[model samples]
Target: MLSKDALDTLFTNARTHNAWLDKPVTDAQLQEIYDLMKWGSTSANCSPARIVFVRSDAEKQKLLGCVSQGNFEKTKTAPVTAIIGMDMEFFEKLPQLFPHADARSWFAGNQANIDATAFRNSSLQGAYFMLAARAVGLDCGPMSGFDADKLNAVFFAGTTVKVNFICNLGYGDAQQLFPRSPRLSFDEACKIV
Candidate 1:
């Protein structure tokens, strides 16, 4: 079990930052986030999440074109905007990632299975990514308010990858944070079987 302070850091006190400080998020920190996130479990171990970290002004400008008006400012000001993508052909690498069994054969040529697994596992990976970022002392602002088609064309053209979501990573501006929203209690949200 983790300590109370650690748990607080990961969940209880974590916030979805809408603004960021001027501090930069480094390449080393980004690598650390992935290193921690990659260990999260996935069905058939199909690790399909591919991230594109947009830091340069050129890349940020491209991203700005795809985001909604509501997301424009936060995303623009963020030090690092991570594009979380899902690869439709992720099964091809299963041989190397899950060498104990023929995992690739299970998803290859099956468009339905491939799509389902890719989306589901990539979504799971996306959640792991946020947790990993928080673990590394970075704040996260995840958003789905973007033109997915445009983003895909801009970031993953001619590839099987599709945008799942985007998240801004940085040292957040706490003064800009809104009051925490309410969440359902365990009994309200879960059932003991």
Candidate 2:
């Protein structure tokens, strides 16, 4: 079993941090987070997630226009806001990530399969990203309270990528947090069929 500290750091102690310090998240740290997330599992290793880190004022302004009002201030003030996305042309990389067979052709011309694979893998990557950020001592505010189509139009225009979610990354201000919310008990949330 994992230590109590490990479990707490990853779950009980982690909060959805909305307020941040003005400190910056270094590019090296961002790359390290991606490196850690890349090792996490995915179907056929389709690893479709693509992230764009928006840190500049102009970029932040563009992102601000795309986010919902509830998320605007937190995102705008974040040291980095990752635009987690899925690449539609992800199958092209199958040769490197899943080379045991002709897996690339399996997704060709199959829109349903393509959509399923991209969304699933990208979602998995997002989860991995959050865990990795926590492991690296960074605070995360993951949100889906935005228009995906507008985000795509603003950030991913002319590209085959679509935004899956936005994660504001930085050092969290615990004082700004509300009291912790309750979660379901094991028996209430799970079934051991």
For lDDT, the strongest prediction is: 1
Off by over 4 Å in 1: none
Every candidate's lDDT: 0.97, 0.94
What is the TM-score of each predicted model, taking all chains together? 0.98, 0.96
- Please give the lDDT score for candidate 1: 0.97
RMSD of each: 0.7, 1.2
After TM-score superposition, what is the CA distance of residue 47 in candidate 2 from its true location, in Å?
Answer: 0.1
| Ten contiguous residues with the weakest lDDT in model 1 | 103-112
Model 1: per-residue Cα lDDT over 65-116, one tens digit each: 9999999999999999999999999999999999999999998889999999
Superposed Cα deviation of residue 125, candidate 2 (Å): 0.5
| Model 2: CA > 4 A from native | none
Q: Give the worst 10-residue stretch by lDDT in candidate 2.
A: 2-11
Candidate 2, residues 23-116, lDDT tens digits: the string is: 9899899998999999999999999999999999999999998889999999988999999999998999999999998999999999999998
